[model samples]
Target: MIKVGDKMPAGTFTQITKDGPQKISAEDFFKGRKVVLFSVPGAFTPTCDAKHLPGFVEKAGDIKAKGVDVIACIAVNDAFVMKAWGKAQNTDGKVEMLADGNADYTKALGLDMDATGFGMGVRGQRFSLVVDNGVVKQVNVEQKGEFKVSSADHVLTQL
Candidate 1:
């Protein structure tokens, strides 16, 4: 898994909107900004849908109040699924949902977890990272199936 203070890996992912495709680069997302980035195993899954993501959405206002420029969520699902799931979660355009469809970004960051035993395939571990101007400042990765850390409130405390 990625650790705090490591230079964030370079990667690009697709974000689909009703209009068309939006290509997002990791550097561009974090450059000259204070970004809170969270990752889930997949979209619409139990823990992620119930706790992980909802916490971010609920505390987004507070997070932004602390000078955060962007709050982003990433998963191994494709852009289409990510977009639909974001809408279902009632994301108020406050959080950007990024699709790491082929595990490219996940693997590049060294946070990919294998769950093929349960048929989850290659997926990102549940984690949150704080990036300042494209540099990693903090990282919180939860134990498998556990949601103790890596929540918005937890990261907010760090900020």
Candidate 2:
């Protein structure tokens, strides 16, 4: 897994907007910026929908007040699903819903979890990382089926 002081891996994530799907590169997104990047195994899952995503959405302003430039949520789903979820959760412009459809970015970060037993295939492990100008400053990764460290409140305390 990526550790503190490590640079974020180079990869592309998709975001669906009114302008349609756009490809965003991690290099472009994180360079010269302090960003909070959090990942969920899949979009609209129980814990993710009920707690993870909403916590970040609710605390986005607090996070930005600490000098965060971007607050992003990544999931192993398509851009369409991300867009819909963002709208449903009222995160339209508050959080950037990034789609790691192929799990390229997840695997590159070494945070890919084998959820085959759950019939979900390869998905990202629940994680939150603070990245400043492309380098990781802090990381919190949740254990299998757990939701302790990688949370908005926890990341806020780290900030």
Candidate 3:
């Protein structure tokens, strides 16, 4: 798993735009920026929809006030689904919803979780990281079926 002082792994993420889905490389996104990147098992999942994404949206201002440049939420879903989830959560101008439909970025970070038993197939684990200019500052990965350290409130304290 990625740890403090390590540069983010090379990968690409899909994000929705006015024109269409745009591909953003990890290096490009993390370079010269302080970012709070959070991941979920899937978009529109019960806990995620109810708490995870909402907490970030609520605290985006507070988080950005602490010198963070970007706040992003990623999930193992298509770009359309992620975009819709962000819209439903009212995250406009706050959280950037990222799509990791192929699980490439999750596996690269060693944060992949198997959810085949739940009929969800491969998915990213619930986690969050603070990255500054492409280097990791903090990483919080939740335990199985648990939500604790990876929360927006928790990350705020760390910031």
Candidate 4:
């Protein structure tokens, strides 16, 4: 998996905007900025909905106060699903909902988890990374079925 000191890979994540779907490149989003990039296996899943995403949304202001330029949530779902989940979570402009629809970014990061047993196919492992100017500064990847790390609070502490 990609670790601290590694540069973020080149990839595109879709974002559903008012004008429709938009493509955002990793370079454009993370280059020259401090970013907190967190990934969930799927959007609107139990743990993700109840804890992961909400934690980031709630702590976004404090995180940004630490000099973070962007707080983003990525999932292996489509832009439409990401948009809907963002709306449901009331994330709106607080967190950028990035859709890694085909698991491109997740695979590129080497964080892809085989969730076939759960009938979810390929998904991203629960993880969070602090990236400064596209280079990873810190990373917290959770063990399977665990949520001990890769949390907003933990990431905040790291920051």
Best of the candidates, lDDT: 3
For model 3, the superposed segments whose C-alpha errors exceed 4 Å read none
Question: What are the per-residue Cα lDDT tens digits for candidate 2 across 61-135?
Answer: 999999999999999999999998998899965789999998999999999988889999999999999999999
lDDT of 3 by residue, 46-134 (tens): 99999999999999999999999999998999999999999999999999999999999999999998999999999999999999999
Over 4 Å off in model 2, which ranges? Answer: none
Q: Per-residue lDDT for 94 in model 3? A: 99
Per-residue CA lDDT of model 1 for 1-159, tens digit only, reads 677787788999899866787888888778899999999998999989998889999999999999898899999999999999999998856788999999999999999999899798999999999998978888899987788778988998988
Please give the ranking of all candidate structures by TM-score, highest first, separated by commas.
Answer: 3, 4, 2, 1
Give the Cα error of residue 45 in candidate 4, in Å.
Answer: 0.5
Go through the candidates in order and give each one's C-alpha lDDT.
Answer: 0.89, 0.93, 0.95, 0.94
Best-to-worst order by lDDT is: 3, 4, 2, 1
In model 1, where do residues sit more than 4 Å from their true spots? none
Q: Between which residue pairs do clashes occur in model 4?
A: none
lDDT tens string, model 4, 38-96? 99999989999999999999999999999999999999999999999999999976899
In model 1, the clashing pairs are none
The candidate 3 region of ten consecutive residues with least summed lDDT is 143-152
